[model samples]
Target: MKFLIVFVALFALALAAPSDKDTVIVEQNSEVLPDGYTANLKLSDGTDIESSGKLEKAGTDEEALEVQGKYTYADPEGKVHTINYRAGVDGFQPQGEDIPVAPVA
Candidate 1:
């Protein structure tokens, strides 16, 4: 009976463990661009969100850059919405404006 209880407890513990495939890891790195160059973030779902302005150094620091971009995503009803983000020395802050999405050609 003790052996059966131990096996059942181990089975329950194994069931409660998190699988590696269910985790997502994000790595932050700086992307360099030429002058007047703009970057676009293309999502895996075919959403092409463009940057509003060029990225520049937030200050004299070499660690981070200021990113000004808009992110667009589609809802279950097929309605697209845009959320603008700005990254500075204080970190990323999302703007409240939601722009309508344009159809991707």
Candidate 2:
């Protein structure tokens, strides 16, 4: 019984562990500063992400960090999807082909 339990637990852990064969980083670059930073990443699985963040309204009561980024990935159906987004005081805003548009009244 002890051996069986150990085997099952090990099997479960193996299943939960991340598999490196499915994903790989093809390229990555980053630059960080006191007030801003930028990052770009490309994956072997046809996924790419680029983003930047800056301290906007610095030293103000409403000071906030603004983030702008874009990401592209392939779906299960092999369709490539891209999203452009911004996040900050105005909240997160994203634009993409797969994103549904709000019906204008």
Clash statistics: count for each candidate: 0, 0
lDDT of 1 by residue, 17-44 (tens): 4443342222222233442234444434
Q: Candidate 1 regions off by >4 Å?
A: 1-31, 34-37, 41-46, 52-63, 97-105
Task: Identify the runs in model 2 with alpha carbons over 4 angstroms from their true place.
Answer: 1-21
Candidate 1 collision pairs: none
Which residue pairs of candidate 2 clash? none
Residue 30 miss distance in model 2 (angstroms): 0.9
After the best TM-score superposition of candidate 1, give how far the Cα of residue 76 lies from its true spot, in angstroms. Answer: 1.5
Decoy 2 TM-score against native: 0.77
lDDT of candidate 2?
Answer: 0.70
RMSD value for candidate 2: 12.2
Question: So what's the TM-score on candidate 1?
Answer: 0.42
Q: Which ten residues in a row have the lowest lDDT in candidate 1?
A: 23-32
Clashes of 2: 0
| Tens digits of per-residue lDDT for model 2, 24-74 | 677878777767677777777777777777887777897777878888877
Deviation in Å, model 1, residue 29 alpha carbon: 18
C-alpha local distance difference test of each model: 0.46, 0.70
